[model samples]
Target chain A: MADVAYLPGLPRMLPALLPADDNSSPWRFPQYFADHFSEVMGWLWAHTWLSVVPVIAGLIIALPIGWLASRHKWAYPPMMTVSGLLYTIPSIALFVLVPPLLGLDPLSPLQVPIALTVYSVALLVRVVADGLGSVSEETLQAATAIGYTPVGRFFTVELPIAVPVITAGLRVAVVANVSIVAVAGTIGMVNLGLLFDQGFKLSTDTPYYPPIVLGLLLCVLLALVLDLLVILLGRMLTPWRKAVRS
Target chain B: MIGNVLRWLNDPDNWNGTQFTTGIWAQLQTHLLYSVIAVLAALVIGLPLGLAIGHTGRATSLISGLNAVRALPTVGVLVLLVVIIAPHFHGRTSKGYIIPTLIVLILLAVPPILSNTYAGVQNVDPAVRDAAYGMGMTGPQVLWRVELPNSLPLIFSGLRSATLQVIATATIAAYVTLGGLGRFIYDGLAQQDYPQMISGGVLVAALALIADLVLALVQRYTVSRGLTKRFSKSTVGGAVAADLEEAGVEHT
Candidate 1:
């Protein structure tokens, strides 16, 4: 039902609004621009690692932080506030500061991923905190009365209740962080951002357009695709999302 | 550790400068001004557009597009825009960068406020709409008089959240070589002054925390108070929602 809301020709609008300016037609994108699909694929290949690694690292940290935050009432809020504070610090400053204390090259690939992971930590911590927090105290008390051990109660009781919120939070954080990693490319060991920077420097003749557009497209697609997965995950993981079996 | 932090917080002058330093107050004032301008700009653009989208059929498309934009890498965007736009503004001195920095910060602010307002308006009770209609109210009249007032509580939460975020993030504007507390952060790091860098970093972090707390209080006091004016909204919502259910009809 919701799918019908999307405009049928919505995908075509961007090109219509900003006509393709490729006079050089280096790729010779033939009868249909999609004919240059190989180029898009190539571009995707170049940046896929940068996008994926940071998101993966963010997830690994956020899941536990979210879980811990959700379980403890007092623990969740203060830490979340702290994390929120951490979330606001500009990435550039944070990166610059790290090299001084950690001896890590500020521009290193490891540095970007590490910085991105820290950013993701704030998001995940908040999400897990909120998700677990929403498990009604009534349900929690009921679980305790039934003799579920603290750990047993977490896995069996609280976690199930929190899954939907946690999944949604993870989805949002992933989308936000992946884009950040792309920015990391601007100053990293290897990144598509470097391509955009290169393209900008070279002007229209730059190898930038195809890669920049393709990279942006990839980023947008990842966001949309991941969002759908999160929706599906939510539906599968939570009773609330699924329609009652008639 | 706590004592060290306390020592920093305790001395009134320490807030603006630690021992015998001036310009701490100036830096603090500049940071506050930049954040305030950015947040206000975002609110101005976001609130009205959000109201329009929230109440219309076009909402889903607009909000999704905005979300996509919101997910954009802030640093990357700055870098990209700086290439095209920053050059025009570049001056022999730092002041030239201020306008572009504000413009970009404003761009960052829009999504949170817009999304929050949309969500707030969306959550407003449909029964309230019906009641306004029942009173022979026109659409805009109903929207402004009934829907917006009712949506205030949630809408304020969005603004609070967004503004707090803007305050934390506006520090990034310092990267353009403009002056703010962020300038301190960059300078501290470049000079390898941990105490000064940490001090600036810690202060900015504290500002964000304080902003979050203050806004949460604001959301509660102002937005909720605004809702009390429409005291019957919830009750009307319940009555109408129940009635609609009985009719085997519900509209999202």
Candidate 2:
């Protein structure tokens, strides 16, 4: 209600004012940027691969499981519950939990991607199931009526129609993975998180802003770029939706 | 390994701290305190904005923008914030780690709460809104009386997800040298105490599940029976799915 004393306007204004304060901080921009430029880029590349591979792997693994859940009514609840439980496990815990389970070194690069794949699969499984379920019964029936086998109908009809929804889930998976992969850095994995750790340790005596600020900017940039790519892909695959709109 | 963890958890020395200052109990309190405060802060910021956006059908882009904030690595954000903000509070006790940790948790919590609330209120039937208007209700009145009650289920679902996320992320607060159950995990990792680390993980998982269960019960009880029946399970699922989709879009 309007009567409620809420300052909804404040949040919208905070971001604009925040950067101005950065100028007064101890860290100088061009100098700091120049100092850490190459190192920052290296970490960014590591972060990108660590975040991205899991999503691709997760999507591949989730497809069959998602398809099975969508095909069988009774499978949905158990699938969602298991994945949901998987998701609730803390990222750091899973990051640590995996190396022991897989008998890998604690700092193994494989650990982060594997842990992230588990998360992406957890997130994407439900997304895949829901996306497949979103297909209209009549449309599916029509496909079957045209003499399509179950596999043929799924590949030819269901999968194409499900692209938007699946892509939507993929975007979430990718972004979430990016954030999570940074956690691995805290435990000594070389990634963008190394930047954060560097910044944190350096700031122990003074608030050194460059590595932290650069890492933040790069992570946000990566997320935005990946998000845009997914949206673009979604639009390309669902050309009929655009045609219908016109 | 499981037996070793159980033994570590049950050890008398593990529970030996003063009333609320040490041991598993104190760590649990620290974890809960961080999560609760962050979630409360998120609700304060997110709920009204979501309701306004839902009612007015405006600033929808804002919701998507907020959703992208969720994608920022929490660990990165936490450390960044600590590096930037911790020095300002350098002389103060506890403020250093607490401030940045709270900021990260609140940031994580806000998106889900905001998005779900917006979706819930917007999804309310237009006919119902028009009917309320026909009865001479003002915009504020209609929002408070009609939209709020109807949107309770989705709002609670958002709160549940946000709470779970905060609890999970709060475990990382210990990485910044704050006290929480994560202290055990971080300490164990540093000391190579596998049993302690595993137990910490077990405790956090248990806490998350328990908290979610409690919230689900609260959600079930608070919503009206008629509204629950009307919304139905599939509608709720659809709402959650749609919210997740929006979350996906925003993160990108």
Candidate 3:
């Protein structure tokens, strides 16, 4: 396997100090970082978008379906069942199966994001339905009595109230997607997961730590940031929550 | 594509082999073996800690920390462990692969179980705990007799989530040369064999569904009848959905 440090078109830093191609020298974080900084940033960039896009796409798609499930008593059971079953499918399986179903190349970069969207939808559907369902009957009547149209009521009243729950679901989806995207790297998808793949491949005779450690750090960091972002977004969307708390 | 996957699955050659790790049956066995072992080990560790936390209401910070651990990518951990630990064995033992894989699987499986158990115990109605204390039950007695029973649904929810995660991760274990259904997916990718890859996907999906179904049934049987009475206002499906919803909300 080729070392990421040797990848073309990136201006090298600390080339003289770069670890041997055979990995003779033990892992050094500074040397590795200097040698492959651009490459690492590229992986992180890909990782961020690959993970975040699916949750956004899934949330967009799930809202109407979840609203229907909450509104129609009969729709809730089947909707939950389908999503639950979908959620049960191993993510790797979904990644591989999705490409064929969609007539895309088996190794398409799109495979993972699409597969994750399935999961986000699977997860958020239940969250959305339950969040919307949490609105009390009296609250709905109040909205109606105030002459808000159903659409207007959903947008102004029910949706705002549902923000915390929906954001909670988004947090889970985002964090889980961050990890699952790395798993796709095992099958050759590009992302922070590729660093894991590279590190593993480099470890035939001796263990390599730099790439794996960097990947782990960046992944955990990404997940935490995304999680905090979702929480902050949740807080921003529900100002009344803080107003009541204060 | 479905036909191709079906044809690949229907082939007897894929299902039979003379040695372990040689066929679909062997891979299935290996996958389940790893998953079940990881879940059980997590249960041993997580259940106790969760019980103590839930019972004493101390060290709640540990639960939050464990929830953050959930965000660690499983494949990265598995590969890192393999890379870091495999060399220590000097190529003389398979423990290099097996140890790291199990560690990752167990690590991945523990959070949900621990948190759910804690939540289940904590969520036990205070009124009921008071009644148990009023009846002269000791703390341990109350935990065993009252909180544990009420906490069954959430505990099982955690168990199911962990099991599903372990099974899925065990498939990724094939990337590290551990034998399982993941072999088909990885090998298929290496060889560009889509049917075989899809077959692996189908088999894993089937395995996970069956495992979840079995766990659901076990939960249905194990939960006390009185608890069912409490949820009787909703249909069984609604009850399960409600439980699932709560599990997701609380665990996250």
The TM-score of predicted model 3 comes to: 0.89
Query: How well docked is model 1, in DockQ terms?
Result: 0.15
- Give the C-alpha miss distance for residue A225 in model 2, angstroms: 1.7
Highest DockQ among the candidates is held by which one? 3
TM-scores for every predicted model: 0.65, 0.85, 0.89
Candidate 1 local lDDT, A186-217, one digit each (tens)? 44335445545444444332222333444455
Q: Write candidate 1's Cα lDDT for B12-65 as tens digits.
A: 775556554545577778889988988888889999999998888475687878
Top-scoring candidate (TM-score): 3
List the DockQ of the predictions in order.
Answer: 0.15, 0.41, 0.44
Worst 10 residues of 1 chain B by lDDT: B82-91
The C-alpha stretches of model 2 lying farther than 4 A from their native spots are A1-39, A101-107, B17-21, B90-92, B135-138, B230-252
Local distance difference test values of all predictions, in order: 0.64, 0.83, 0.88
The best candidate in terms of lDDT? 3
Q: Taking the true A–B contacts (Cα pairs closer than 8 Å), what share appears in each candidate?
A: 0.20, 0.63, 0.88
Winner by TM-score between candidate 3 and candidate 1: 3
Q: At residue A104, give the lDDT of candidate 1.
A: 55
- What is the lDDT, from 0 to 100, of the residue A123 in candidate 2? 96
